[model samples]
Target: MAVPYVKGIMPVMDQRVYVHALLDQFEARYSGAGGQFRYDGQAWFGSDYNKLWLKSEGTVGTDGRFGDGDHEILYDRSISRYFDVQSGVRLDIDHGPTRAWGAIGLQGLVLYFFDAEATFYFSDRGVAGRLTGSYDIFITNRLILQPQAELNFYSNSDPARGVGRGLSDIDTGLRLRYEWHRKIAPYIGITYSNMFDKSMFFRENNGKNNSGVNFTFGIRSWF
Candidate 1:
């Protein structure tokens, strides 16, 4: 006797991974009398519904030599269509007492256009929070303008890191770029930064200015 023929169906799963490098900033500061570089980027692995995420950002000064800077590393989970809730760590690696922080944050696209992030941090020294927002405007098919702002607040003074209670600092910048390709664009911009409250006093005591402007020239890219 011959058995009846049958076919088995198997479930299919979709999986993918991606990496992007965003907001690369290299600029010369007039007040600090130095050059600075900054970068923010992320990578993720897994399926559409769930994934492991890694995000990082850092800044360094280049006056005569390269030195340590403030850096962050975060792990994130996508909980909604437009947002990710993240938690990780931050390290202040510049010319002061090196301090580590526990970080929790939300990053996402708002209203289908604006990119925004808000993060809170806790350290042995104090509590801190940072909020950032940026929007892109297209003047033509290839030419684009971006305006960005970041504000930082603290719950206590951290003289070791030059931060203060209440609002610590605000930074704003405007950039215009012509996309040479979808992956690369050289841009020019200006940034204005100001420190407030006890943060200003700390700067003054350290022989640094409380506010300044920077001229930025850099390339923004991703892959």
Candidate 2:
């Protein structure tokens, strides 16, 4: 009798990678005491439902001095069509001693097409939280308007870093951009930022204005 032949099973291959970046806040402040630069961006790689994500944001003075910055690497899992649950480690690099925190965050698109992110962090110093929201309005195929806001809170004061407990600060801005291409756009806008509660006191003692409106011009791009 002839021996029976068997078929070999093939291994599954379901892998993908993606990269995206944005210069969310790269502009010059016209009314501020000094020029400043800010940036926020992220990149990720993974399969359809799971990914390794890295995010970073920072602010600096034009004199080439670093101010405040945070970096996070997280495992992101898609929980729904519009949201992702992320848990990771966050590192704060600023004027004071570097601190590490456990971070958990939610990122999603909400009703009325708003992009939102909320993250909570805890470290030996204390707990902190950040909330950000933004929306885009289209005026034409190439013209767009964006409004954005961010709020920060802390549980304890850190004099070395000029941070205070409770509600620390809020920043709001509006930008109008003309896209030369889908991946690049130039924008002009105005921003209003203010410190609250003990955070205001810290600014006062440091001879800094508690609030101001600034005119900004910059470019927003992604790839």
Q: lDDT: which candidate is best?
A: 2
- Put down candidate 2 lDDT per residue, 1-223, tens digits, no spaces: 6545557854444455665556676666667465567677777778767888888877666556566688899989999999999999998886646889899999989999799999999988889999999999999999999999999999999766667898888888999999998888989999888888777887678654436788888888877
Clashing pairs in 2: none
* Per-residue lDDT of model 1, residues 95-208, tens digit only: 667788899999889995799999999977788899999998999988999999989999999776678899998888998888989878888888887889899888779654
Q: What's the lDDT for residue 10 in model 2? A: 46
Q: Which stretches of candidate 2 lie over 4 Å from their true place?
A: 1-15, 207-210
By TM-score, who's the top model here? 2
Clashes of each: 0, 0
Give the alpha-carbon lDDT of every model.
0.74, 0.82
